[model samples]
Target: MGWVACWFIPAILQVVRKHLCLRHDLRGFDGGPSACSRKGCVSLSSCSEAVSMSKVLPAADTLPTVGKKLLKGRRYGLIAHGASITSRGKLILEFLEDAGIEPPQVIFTPEHGLFGEYAYMEPVPSDEKGWRGVPIISLYGSSFESLAPPQRTLSNLDCLVFDLQDIGARYYTYLATMAISMEACARAGVQFVVLDRPNPIGLSDIEGNIPKPYLRSFVSYLDVPNRHGLTAGEVARFFAYKRGLDLDLLVVECAGLVRPMQLPDTSLPFCPPSPNINDFECALLYPGLCLLEGTNLSEGRGTTTPFKVFGAPFIEDPFAFCARLNEFGLEGVAFKPLFFVPKYDKWAGKRCGGVQAVVLDRRKIKPLLVGLCIVWTAMHIYREGFQWRREPYEFEERWLACDLLFGDETIKTLIEMATSPFEVYEYMNAQSKSFVEESRDFFIYPDSV
Candidate 1:
């Protein structure tokens, strides 16, 4: 599925290309938001003259705790990561202890270390020193990286629970891990519960081209809108229901959560899913810009600021004057030219030129499209400076880094064709809409919202 501008405007075409525009059809052409509210279709009389509206959540404290109920009578395995299990709604051993869980039998971790202390792409494994002395199992072992659990690991556990916070981008591997564990639980006859959380990137507002099934990876387990509008619990429920897997799956519904709730208002802590994604801006920028990691040019790796900014020592464009990145006229994001030397990762200690993305509206920012534009733009502008890593990603060689990141080579081909950014956005958004419709059966939320 790709972006289809044709349907979007015919329906909710609000402000004739005005930034911060919201349109309401039932309200006499006034931008009052008759469309999906949770989908970033927020109701606004005008950009200015704001009022304190109702909080876009149901209230976390009011909801019944699922972990407590699940751990009521048995000890089980806990599979989580630092970001997956946050202080906001994190499943701690204390919560289980308070709920009278004898003790967790084990903890399974994804690519990032259990505490999210390790750098990106580092394989985190089982640790005897994990929370409350529970052994941390590494799912990314050389032989175990394929999104499924070994039969041996499931022999002792009766149920498994996953509580992760997702930024809702495709390449973020947390969902992949959840998918793998869900399938394994389905196969092993184990009960799996997914505790729900808000999708930081509102579900209604989506972008990016659908990755063909051939472009599948751990990063993308199911064919979904690139910026999917659902929670981890909802994703799991949809996965089990649509796939016809009759596992004893349960989702702890999040309380008081409304669609399109801004990330800061959710009352949830922002824990970087990985080491370099240290802040919300990084995660917000990731959907579009993460591809730089696979390129020879450093995307600001090994520094205090990673993903939010990028720079490489070669072929100067610190000001982006030569590249004309802003000339592409992308929306919702303001690019301020900057330069910096990375502390460690890709281009350590070299002053590389790049811009710090100032996200004007996280609700409207589509990082995936932004990322693709940059990849295509830099590939042409810098000429000799642009080089695909060519190195294997997640231990696969057949696929290039660009292919893995974008989910298909077709995008790369189009980018190389010098396709306009809007055309690219529409293509991706169209594919994404197709995915949303296809995934309708799996949705647990109201169809309209």
Candidate 2:
């Protein structure tokens, strides 16, 4: 029966792949869902026609239905940015005004500020004068202490409403801001409300190791997987449970969203979550490429396609470097050798030998694995030139950037031991599976269709 099933399944999936116009098989030999070639197509069992036709709305859109009841008597502050908009393109503040709901007494902006204009790790200027009349507070400041809302600030508000668009990477910092702010709210006796949005990378592809307890920093506030398969609301629940916080937490669920739906699956417009992440493709690549920040590599920061293209001036052979990466035979992604000059960040104004990582099939690609291979290959081929960044990252100077980004020295050890990428994948995949089992209780959305 097993032998017959294996042969039968492959033949059936091949037919289905052709029928759906899919670029890859509907499922791999391992039976995992492959990337859907059709734009806006969703899930393993569904295509564009099989999934719901309704446009997915951010939880902010449901605010009209639930906000008045929750905020009628409570003084609230909103943690949001420009991307905090409804499906119809109404900004959070504008939606609040239109819905006849009272504006938050104070608005909190994350790392990129309210409009997402600030550069990476740049301190956002706090506006006591407020934007459009509401007092604006910057959560991301120069000091590590400033990453969270002050307890004094929290005390004034009966509730703190969080509505930032998280791109589903641990190092993104917005989720960290949310988790830290939640801790502060718990301390200050404030209710925390999370206006959930879709995990833009989708919920199916959880990867990477959870940072060790000692490696916890602004970038990794909570010990979650790098590609955590949960929404902002789910993370909040997980945080509350893990920390045993005795505080009120409410999650206003998004409409027309499911675990299998990536950002493209939703008809919602892609807003750059941060200044560097300009599109959905950038966000898709961020989980692994973000590790480049801890290295000498230029993560295409100043280029037109940050995260999509990465390189450094030291890499003398672009073609050789790309050839090595492609030889790994990684799935759903391809590396094209190129040269670029960054306008600002790393290797600024210097031509760097690099490669553009093009996503051939989004769903099938393991971005973390792709990123690991890039770094590993570079380290292997350019041993004389490649270097791990030693500068202070996320305000800590104690550990190397790679160690912090990876959550431990284990990855560095693995690379130093000259282990294969598959071995590294085995280690990280084991950790990811453990995280899934532990975090399952906190999941608000169903994992299956």
Candidate 3:
């Protein structure tokens, strides 16, 4: 196994070179590192030997059956929002089949859709699936706000089962779906069941500030950390408990899951549920750069590489842009200069100067801070082209898109005012203040990453 786990580039580079042509069977390819930036990547060996292995998931061995937990007769709703074969979610899906539990009348899905087939920003429509063609309600689509279905849609189902794979970012929307769904279940008088999955970003230290209630969009429904250190089951329980919703929620906790472990080894396959986000590396940076969705600069969307490398048609000097980023000495990674044209998203066939994110040290990078620089620099260097996306984002009519993402307008306004990093940090403290206090009750796990 690669000691680097899934967060370091050097370790991955070294391992890749050592086994470059050693054999068809190179060890630790999938296990080496999770995700890294391509901005300042000096590892030449990494670019040359990029071979991906297809991993097959394990068959279920000892999944918990419904008969084991239920009192012979109990109704429940199965929320399978975090659907990925790698995590324990597969076990839960199999459990539904193996656990002698009666068929759930209603099944709810989170962001990324049922099979994660929907593109990012595109809402999934309500659909049906299963061997017998079970109805798959799209919680991400037309009725994404709450879990209430036609009393007829959920009429057959008496209980709710919630299980999905979350990448641990506040604006990711899955958490919001979970919260709103819980509320709906509460109102509909349904029992909710939650099967948990670990936060792939790990339950280490929380980053960034929580979004204020007013800043709350579909992304941040509550005061959870940027990279919330809780599982789906735990977060659901927290909502049910703390929010004091009169919903009956139960969690089927995982026995083998743990914190700090990145994907490709979480016992699952990779699915590009959303566009631009294909792996853990992109996911790691998503919490921050996703804010660019509100900006005119291309966050590398509409191309082979998205989010990892962002540039606009006007960015004439890629080198100088990277220089500004390096001056910040952003931790855990370095920037790599590159130039490319997008076939779709922003530039669309026109050559644009940009750098690919090169993750030098995966464990140490401050994605939010780095993302701040990326956005601020866009405004600084390409002031002419830079503009905030206006109009209702995810339903907020007048609120600025950047504000909802950062969870506050201070960061957005601070950048507008060219605030220094030190000043921004202080501002984040205030935005994050209430989070620390309310989290006292939400800390379901010990302070050990």
Tens digits of lDDT, candidate 1, 213-255: 7767766565565666667765776676656886887665444
Query: Which is the winner by TM-score between candidate 1 and candidate 3?
Result: 1
lDDT of 3 by residue, 189-208 (tens): 77666545556665544566
Q: Tell me the whole-model lDDT of each prediction, alpha carbons only.
A: 0.62, 0.79, 0.59
Using lDDT as the yardstick, the better of models 1 and 3 is 1
Q: Pick out the ten consecutive residues of candidate 1 with the lowest summed lDDT.
A: 21-30
Candidate order by lDDT, decreasing, is: 2, 1, 3
- For model 2, how does the per-residue alpha-carbon lDDT over 308-382 read when each residue is reduced to its tens digit? 999998887899989888888887899999999999988999999999999999988888888888888778778
- Pairs in steric clash, model 2: none
Give residue 1's error in model 2 in angstroms.
Answer: 51
Local lDDT at 81 for model 3: 41
Q: Model 3: runs farther than 4 Å from truth?
A: 1-62, 66-68, 71-76, 86-95, 98-102, 128-131, 143-152, 256-275, 447-449
Model 2: lDDT to the true structure = 0.79
Q: For every candidate structure, what is the RMSD over all alpha carbons to the true structure, in angstroms?
A: 8.1, 10.0, 13.3
Clash count, one per candidate: 30, 0, 33
